[model samples]
Target: MNIEIKVAKKSFNYSGPKNWEETEPWLYAKIFGIGKQLAEKPHALFALPQMIFQIPTNVLQFLFDRNAMRMVGVKDEEAQDEVMGQGYALLKIAQSFANSEAPFSWKVPKVKAAFLGYNYYGPGDSLGMLTFEEFWFAEAAYERNDTNALIAVLYRRDPYRKQTFSEELTEKTLKDLQALPELTKEMIVFNYQGCRLGFSKKFKHVFPKKSVEKDDEQQPKKTKKNSGGWLQVAIGMAGDSSVEFDALRKLNVIVALQMVENKLIKVKQLKRKTK
Candidate 1:
């Protein structure tokens, strides 16, 4: 006789990755703080991890250095020429994508992902859902497939529209985003590295209580510019200036891929049939 007993598989809630604060506070900041901006519910759309992982390493390096070099102010016509020479390889890669047959539209995930860390409706509950196009809404549901903890922040204030995850697939949209206008060097550098910005102002005070309350009341209110990455080169937050550039470079690669996955870059169609 054979044993016939079977045990049930245990299923636990998705509590999110462990040690979010210690391990990846930057990622947490995007998933957490950006949503806090709206008076109503706010949701963040992130490119799927598989899409992010597909970016070529050289492209990532180019973007990282491009942003970093700009940050340090690589100026002058001669210097600019030298910079372009250094970026020749990157330019070739970009040209290849431009010549590809697949519509940039094709790169966007058929099923995109979002993260809803806070329940705007109530505790442990959801409100309304949104299609990925709309940036802000009363409430939006996070997709379940957003499992990979990695994300790239699209740093824009209210009404600042860029081609985000299929908002537009026109050549003009691709050109504008590629130029990265209204964006500071820091914003490009840090955001590309996946370091969350604007959270420093919120997360600055660890113990949110009486002391902080008194300080807030006493401090004069000041307007903070929406541009620039708040956490870029923030020694206090990172704990030291010794943080490795290699890691930063790697993280930015995903951000760069997210750019493609969002369809912000135009990939030329391989063949266009004559009408």
Candidate 2:
């Protein structure tokens, strides 16, 4: 199948997977929280029956280690030796449409997927909708053909302008969008991937919530500076010094994903999950 993926080594402002514990509290309380959302939404849908056998701690270590190597000089320095760093792989894609009407799924395969904007046709204008070049929005905007899923809207909002995407091909695709009169084919497609979360070695949380007032001026920045994964480790290390505490977690990743599906969480949910 044609999937237009827009992957970055760092996206949603994190270099890699989210910290686990940040996700634990809600996952533990909500879906797994005894008569919470999950139990209510999914009564008959059986879990895929995969019980935890073992989690290779080594793999976890590999995924969470602070890829501490430093790089500052140009290419060909002795310290520029190729070394295996620590981190996990995250792959994602966005979809775009010519007419902005069709719905598409973001599941890699069979997993339950999250829904995107509803009534998203932004303030009626020449352009029917508007969205930032965020990852989830990109995935939610994906367009499909017989062989490939194409994404091009991000390129529209690019630091570098690559193409105008006005072609017969684009016009044909938007023909399926019943929202407006036929548009000239202006859709271009692209995919992104293979990014590593390796750039936050010397940063710290500059702003804490308590210090900042909750007003327009006091509003936290739209994005964070570090690959929030570190914050996750800090959170996990808070109460317990051992894996026992982690294992004691009542809610799992699946439940969290389900909660997201059920409209139970808000913005904080995406920025606060562990791999």
**Most accurate candidate by TM-score:** 2
Per-residue C-alpha lDDT of model 2 across residues 1-275, encoded as one tens digit per residue? 12111112311122211221122222212212222223465431121110011123432232223232232221332322322221212111101111122111110111111132221111111111222112223334442331121232322222222322343423433332323211111111111110001111112121122232355777765544344432243334335655643432222322322333333233346557742
| Candidate-wise lDDT, in order | 0.26, 0.24
Residue 173, model 1: Cα distance from true site in angstroms: 5.8
The window of 10 residues in a row where model 2 has the poorest summed lDDT is 193-202
Q: So what's the TM-score on candidate 2? A: 0.17
| Candidate 1 residue-wise lDDT at 12 | 17
- Cα RMSD (Å) per model? 28.3, 25.6
Q: What is the lDDT of residue 100 in candidate 2?
A: 21
Residue 30 displacement (Å), model 2:
23
Candidate 2 has an lDDT of 0.24
Which stretches of model 1 miss by more than 4 angstroms? 1-202, 205-243, 252-275
